[model samples]
Target chain A: MTSSAQANVSSPVRAEKPQRKQMSDMTIRNLFIAPTLLLLIAMNVFPLFYSLYLSFTNYSAIARKAPVWVGIENYVNILTDPQMWQYFNTTGKYTLLTVSLQVVLGFALAMLVKEKFAGSGIVTTLILIPMMLSPVVVGLFWKYMYNPSWGYLNWLMGFTNPSVAPDWLASSWARKSVPGLALFAVVFVDVWMWTPFVMLLVLSGLKAIPDYLYEAAAIDRASSWFQFWRITVPQVAPLLMIAILFRTIEALKSFDLVMGMTGGGPGDQTEVIAVNLYRKAFLGQWQTGEASALAYIVLIIIIAISNLYVRYLNRLREG
Target chain B: MATIELRNIEKRFGETYAVKPFSLTIQHGEFVALLGPSGCGKTTTLRMISGLETVSGGTIHLDGANITWQKPGYRNMAFVFQFYALYPHISVRENIAFPLKAEGMAKSDVYKRVDEVVSILRIENLLNMRPGKLSGGDKQRVALARALVRKPAAFLMDEPLGALDAEYRESMRAEIKRLHLSTNATTVYVTHDQVEAMAMADRIVVMSAAEVQQVGTPADVYHAPANLFVARFIGSPGMNLLAGPRRGEKVELPGTGNIYTIPAPQREVLQAATPEGKNVIVGFRPEAAMLNEQGALTGEVYATDMLGAYKLLHVSFDSDTVVHIRCDRMVSHPIGARVRFDLDPQQVRFFDATTEKAIGPTQSAGTAPISVQAANAQEKAA
Candidate 1:
């Protein structure tokens, strides 16, 4: 029996199959998925490559001529422009203010609602309503609410003192006296719309913690304050960082809210990078090449920051 | 070490009572186990002693001081959870040092204490490894080290070995017993596994459906169960019980047409404890009954089991009544074979069929007969 088994293993036999026209599994699978792959490449990959090609050349939408190879001239011009630096500074400040506020307020709200109480489900759903709304719709509604004359905020402030109703969107003081107020108007709108997104992520993180850990800590004679610092904070830190990373990227590329609320106005006081790119590409000179270059620069910065956060997240998971 | 006394402690969630009013006292350095099936209030009782749950009706005294309303942190006890609950982010050294550091101990002192505990649990090699990197048994050792570092007022373990493999559980059980002897910390363990309770605890408190059934030494509970619940719950495969009505000097087993002659002593106790024309249950461990050529009780062998160290023959007197008889390993009985067995009257116990409470000489000395009203109240509460 052993010799026969060894002989069978040593010998290789080949058998011929009957001819058929049936498709193989791999071919059938690829055939089914072909349409989605084709549509994705056409809609997304094509535009991305076209924009990269346009970034290094002189291209104008209104020119009606073939774009000329400029040999890095668009990148050089955008890199050296003082106005571009100012736009970057504006973008940095807006990202810092909005994302930081969203993280702090979002985590605080998540902690508050982590435990079940009467009507908590309804309250949590209501809190998430703002994040569920379309950004365009939110911007449009907030614009009317920021109107200096008949806005609800000004009217509500009219109750205390009818004399001083600070101009929200087009305040001259925002440009001359306090430049931050102009930035604050748009930052407030963004924070209101996105804080709920951060809250939902952190809430899931909070929910993943088991109750026995806290009970064990209590038995170990750890105070409430000690439990918060030692247990609660460490358990939620990774998710909180992820929330911050997402909000930072979204804030850096902010355009719709700024456009609808302040239009980068009171004289470019709130002209973030995305809004400036929009203005350069479509509004006035239509410098599509320079705008594309600026867009690539923003993308690189976002990728670098996101990579740092991802590394930290991996380390946290390992720990 | 400290003595923990609970006086009529009860716990309620909304309108449903999780624990009925029960009182117990744990002497200093005594190891007590709360043994019961799932949802039988064993864990709840352990949590109350640890001050992790609030008592709805009574007070608790730790070392003669009232600590009923004190916070769990202030109660100065350590809890080992079923899943270990070791902080996943911390190293074994840091996890063991947590309770000490929380008390504002000096860093040098904390390290020294952690080293001592790690050596005791033989987890010194795993000091720098986080819980996430450790195996389940290693994590359990670290959890035990953490609980042992502080020398708290008492230790409360909620099925700490329940998650381990069978072999690991055996070693951990011995480890816990050794630690209890060396540390002499008052310990309250909660588990549904009767073997764990019998092996490690000095006294086992058996509970059923939010009520205490019996509390006694391991041998006492096994040899003499207080009620039907305790009798059936404390043994492997449980005690074999035959229910029937008493007639003259024998029990006429219902539906089996079989008669078990009651021994002279047991017959007297059953007659005094229960009225005539009422049902009675004869209880005996599987090991207490043996095969004999001259035995009067006869049945057909329904099944046979070879349990390595011994053989068990499951004999059926009728379609409904079956009893197990333990025999020597070499004694093999085939299925459908006729067998005769005799129960050792010295190990036999009788129970009142109506109240389900033990009716024998072995019922704890000086205990009052359960009144009809109290039995009715217990039924309604259940």
Candidate 2:
């Protein structure tokens, strides 16, 4: 009976003891983690929300009048505008082309460096140097390289023709030609720069594969091609998916290279969504509301792509 | 099923010789274990046989055909890796079906074989799960299931149970033994654990330093070890070897002043071979040197451990030869107490100092308390 009375006192104490302990632990974690999270929310989350709000209102930079709640008007106007749609199409084309080419070239370069070749480290370092450099610098460099008179590519191609050198940045041919060439220039630069990132990921994944698996595969009499497709591909798939997702997002939000290289060029023919949005918001007299809506649209697209990648990462972890 | 023969096989990795001029003939349906310490060419030999490693010299024959240059799959042998290299992305069902599918087996047949192996291994519950989700034991079973599904000419297993916990290893050992019996496939297994080799193998090839020391049943390797390395390597506590001088019929032990008499059958060889008072290494099992009232040597107990069925006693004599004696677990003795022991001359062997080879006549080196000689005799007869 005395023990029972002690138990009655101890049970509540024991139950409350864990609760208090958990509360203190949580309080300690909150003390450390809360401020950084709050700072992030204020800087990023607040701007995002304000941008969304501005997107719904007709906020003007020049008029100095209070923004009127215009609801779907900005969205409708942007949707009806053919130039906006053209920019959208150009953005899609640019993203798809660059990402595709980058992945293929990156994967190929990764394979080359993956082997234990002499000077591979130097080569890898050289390849990665492009990505670390200023994007604006890259744009300026390519702009000079594509110059009509003495550009390296033109000079190289000039050997095939004595006098028929086409101007890379002039005429209707140049308008259509230069954007693709410029897009490819950016893509080549991206591949040259970012292939090392893909290579590093793939190399780690490749290393995680025990040599014994390849030995077993060899014992199974699998051809080299079979081993690559069956063993190498499957093993590298998860990392490759992650790499593609990353590059796709980066490609879609491509702004700086386009800005530095062409500045929307030759009657807005080379204008991507980013360039078009910049022009609408800053160049054209005060359409901050529409710019904000366009900015939110970019955010939504990025988040959707990022969410898919997150799910993929979760699946890989589970697997 | 086919007999596999390795003829003077040598495998060199750059300057280091992994396996040196090794030869073996494994009869069909016989389970052989290439037993040794790590880096002792046992795995290299297995790999060479399975065609995983290219031979630097000599040839391999499967069913009387030279297969040294052939690919592993063409040789029709399946290998189970030590790490159980199951495709991590594939489910257990797919892992088991891989080898079969590799040979382009029909879908229906693959399903049937996969189903059969899964049930046999009792991994049906785990068939849909990836190797990442499987436990150590389950992964090993799946590896085995995969190897066996194809029913190739021979099976090469490299320490398949090395990764499992002790308890699981014992059970898997039994499972492997049962599978070997039922399947009757010509199998070559590699392991460092003598107990595993003893339990699962029909014949064990004892090796060291890229060369085979002996090839026989577990009993033969234990009782009739071919050399100094094998005598020390094959047993648990190892054979007790005392270096001394032989004069007439008696081999005199150094420091301890213990005299061992050469049996009548081996007396002539001892006299002709060993000069009077010439040093030699006399070998005997710990059980051969036992506790007796009318014993020749006196020892003090150094340590004792009660190992379930038997107790192990480490006794240090005046000569500093600490002999390990196994007694019943119920028996107890104080650590400092002096104990008397007799060296049974009938159950002893002699080796030459120069060659480190067994030379003098070997008698019933088994009749000692922990004798495996009867098992040895039975195995030799088999």
Candidate 3:
């Protein structure tokens, strides 16, 4: 009976007109998706090519260097320059330090805020204020706090000895350490501010889990540690990965704090790639060609990091 | 297997009592249903037993040990949720293996048990797929399989089939019954649908307004509902009710001008329970109301609902109230046509005007075999 019914209905289903109609319908469906596709391409793709083209040309906003095709000259110079390498190393250290602290502190804050309690809303609101404040304002405020003489940092550190009170913006110690300290300060501020963001996202993710799943886990007589590892972590991973990716992107592009606090420092010791690019463009005698090349280099590094983050995001989504 | 005992379990959220002094003992290997409408404390009772919700005042005992303060895991029972609660990221095999793995079972044994459950649920082909990719019925089977694989003390399910399509729910209902029979596991199922409760539960615990109305076998509850709420709740087309006065020998409906001669014994019981010339509500099952050529109380057929196997003819009186008469499916009754119907006086039930509880001894009527003596005693007490 099944075979006879299948035999009767098979031909009509396989008819050509239905197939043609489906194709046209799909084309019309694709038309609805076109705007989003074009927007994404314009925002992400066009800038990439524009920067790539600028890298080979000596295009400067001030010097207005007519782009002579100096194939890889800027690349060769920037690759070999010790100062450029110094900036790369500085940027890498900042990214690693900031992202790690953000993740750990973010996880802790998320866990704390996830539970229902009195005044949790106020705590969350207070914690989130630092992140929402402008980066430039935060850097300026910290600079005032670390102003060496009347600085709050010195006062807080309790420097009774006038001789031992270290210079924050002048000496070699100040140069190397100030930028790193400022970056750490920014990272601390980032963790303070954005940890709540991570908490909010993770809180929603945690709440989404029906209480029955945890009950099931408990009925298995799972230990506290075991439940955290198996159920809690697995449930929170997808959102955590997304949060980490967002923080990483923001950390790699860190520039405002270093600029406002150290001003690329006692001797270019604190200059990240973004700050270096700024210096080359305007401060270092308006070397537009070198700045364009440096800009392209920063763009390349960001693209590589973003690509890695996107791959992890895609894998998390799939799982 | 474990015997779960609840001693006057009460729960309150803020100021409102969600469950009021609920008490019951679930025997080992028995299938019981907490059946009621939404917000009637059925799910709340199930959660309290599972230790997911804290009881305001109660003691919970499982297998002779008081576990009132114990956490959910210490209760040693598996719960299949209405949402399935299958981790969407995990494969079907892992979802089934989760409880065993959490208990630190060996890898080989976990795999073997997963395989056993997969075969039992006929989901071998779907073992490698994630829950997000499965159909609704398939996901339901996976949830059932996951719950059963643990073979814990008992299973508490909250409307597990509520999300399935009608055909799938029917098939799953049969499958769940078979699963229960094969395993002989104690199960507590919650549902608003009386049909589901009647079809699946060995005993149905009827609840309403944060209180347990009655607990009995499906046949017992259907034939002898304790109050007006249970009577209307447990039956399809519900029980037809008419408000009237019980005179010495006959009860007369004032608005419809219908008088029913009361049996002498029932009249005596009614007299003892209530004052003479007092108003009372009379109730009867739709199937008990039969149409006869030579009967009293003429009414016009308002509507006919054909349900394949049985048909219901809704009859309306000159008064605003209506009563449904169950009849054969193919036996067509035209709407707007006048029909005379007789009430099987023996099958009728009387409830107190103030309390709405069954008031007197009800004789066996229609296909009902059990005398509602217990219900009458309860009504008298009420």
Candidate 4:
């Protein structure tokens, strides 16, 4: 009687749900993925193709005329301009300076913090604040610090000598040459903000390297310096290359930092490609078509540079 | 050649021990294996000898010199890791030459050393490949080549074949033993595999619970375990133990009506070790139980397993006890069938029930086990 009573309770639970046709795995997968796929096509892919089309046409944001198909004229104009070349040269300088300094300082910092000691976790977390910061905020604060009169930098510079605290924003030497002292000021800010990114990458790479490799190397009688050259450096190279790739592109497209800090002032010494593109498209006459062409040129360049680095990265992995 | 000595060396984390104080002397050109289960401090002992781990107390002597504080690099010993930690960014040739290059040898001499090692390992075809591109076996061979190229004072291996599949493990085990015979470099190997330790080691150091349980040759550990742990640890199917209260001439087995008669030779030793009313444990290898019509013990067949060369019959003398016995593979026994078997006097051993240590006169062939003992037992088996 007890067994029949228990069976009476459990049987209806099984019978309550009627059999339903099952969905195939592929159909269910597509059903779940369609929303995300459509959103991506609308938000990202459409804009990308639209921009590619606009790159070949003469279209201005404030103009009264419809966009006219100019075919390669805007591309030709942007490519032939010497000032655009100068902007690219400045972008190249910025990429090179920021990437190199960030790699060196970041990798050194990673090594220093790799060995755990008291408060090391706190140090790592604290260093991530700059990388977490918005570029515009960093630019504004650094701009305040770089002010010539009664600014924090000049106040500190007055310690060495009062009379020789030169103007940072208005120095003639900065405006006289490409990538002069004023450009270095902005480069310094970029490096300050992004060095932690490289540090985190190298830290992860260092962590992935097994302790046994170093043990094996030590047992092989390889000196600490030898181990660094043979094991640590080579082991972390691919990650370092990835860090370089990220920073190079970011530095090339730097707009807000240079705009907030220098505003391409002192006669455009610190104008990177992105800042120049911003000025061309929106600030002055709104040359949107030429700016669009220039943007595509920069995009192609980024792709080429990334392709090279990725190839090198793959080789490092396989080698 | 190098002789490594650890005298009362130990490791501790706060109040707990990773390895309690223990001492052993590995002679020059001898292959010694520190054998135990995971977390048994065998790896820690091997690391201490290699100077990769600093001893919490006591000094380590290398060839009669106190090299306890020496840097691991300056120790001039080669270590092969279990996972084959080859330098991933270099060719196998550069990997083998890494140490020689560090020594500031000329390029030609470095290449010559690398070539010599590759030829010795018969891995010349893999010279140009990176370690990531090699198979597990090939990678291990490259790691071995790297270690051998330096011709260091000694070699330390931490379960070097533990990562290989069964197909490669046997061949690599034989290859490593062959390498040892050819080099005759004093080697310290750490492994938890009894088969590995038994096959290659000149001396096996069986460890448990952060202490050395026993140290003996493979045959000694198998035939005459120094304690119950070694008896349970050394064999594929470990020794069968029957606990009983010791009576005048026979021990009354628990959970069974039968009584065990102490084999004639060890009766005096067994009686002397335990009090008259105290309990003793009888131990025997599976092969030591012989089927006889007028056998001393009778039990029902509890289970049966077909080993490759023999059938293992588990006999239940009562509901609570089952004893494994090896019989001819051609014979079969149904479950619950009565089988009579007698223990071979030569292979029987007795342990004190309280201390879990073997009684004296532990071996029949005089090949006594030295695999047991440590300076401390408060933190015995972990």
What lDDT would each prediction earn against the true structure?
Answer: 0.85, 0.79, 0.78, 0.86
RMSD of each: 7.5, 8.9, 10.8, 5.0
> Which one is best on TM-score?
1
Q: Which model scores highest in DockQ?
A: 4
Q: Report the Cα lDDT for residue A72, model 4.
A: 98
Worst 10 residues of 2 chain A by lDDT: A169-178
- What is each candidate's DockQ, to 2 decimals? 0.61, 0.45, 0.39, 0.66
Q: What are the per-residue Cα lDDT tens digits for candidate 2 across A238-275? A: 88878878877877777777787778675565688888
After superposition, candidate 2 runs with Cα above 4 Å error: A1-46, A159-163, A166-189, B330-332, B344-346, B360-382
Give the interface RMSD of each candidate.
1.0, 1.4, 1.9, 1.2
User: Which scores greater on TM-score, model 1 or model 3?
Assistant: 1
Task: Write one digit per residue (lDDT tens) for candidate 4, span A33-81.
Answer: 9999999999989978877888888999799888889999998998898
Predicted candidate 3 versus true structure: per-residue lDDT over A1-319, tens digit per residue: 9999998897677684576556777798889999988997899788667667767876766654566677788788999998789889988887787778777777778788878799988887887787788878887887787676777877789864435665564442322443445455545655655666677677777777777667667765678788787778878888887887787777777778778877777676667788888888788567666777887777678889888978877886787
**Which ranges of candidate 3 are over 4 A from the true structure?**
A1-54, A58-65, A165-200, A203-212, B254-257, B330-333, B361-382
Docking class of 1: medium
- In candidate 2 chain B, what residue range of length 10 has the lowest lDDT sum? B369-378
Least accurate 10 contiguous residues by lDDT in model 3 chain B: B370-379
| lDDT of each residue in B240-302, candidate 1, tens digit only | 898888877888874444688888877777788777767899898999887897777789999
Model 4, which residues run further than 4 Å from truth? A1-60, A66-71, A159-163, A172-179, B254-257, B362-382
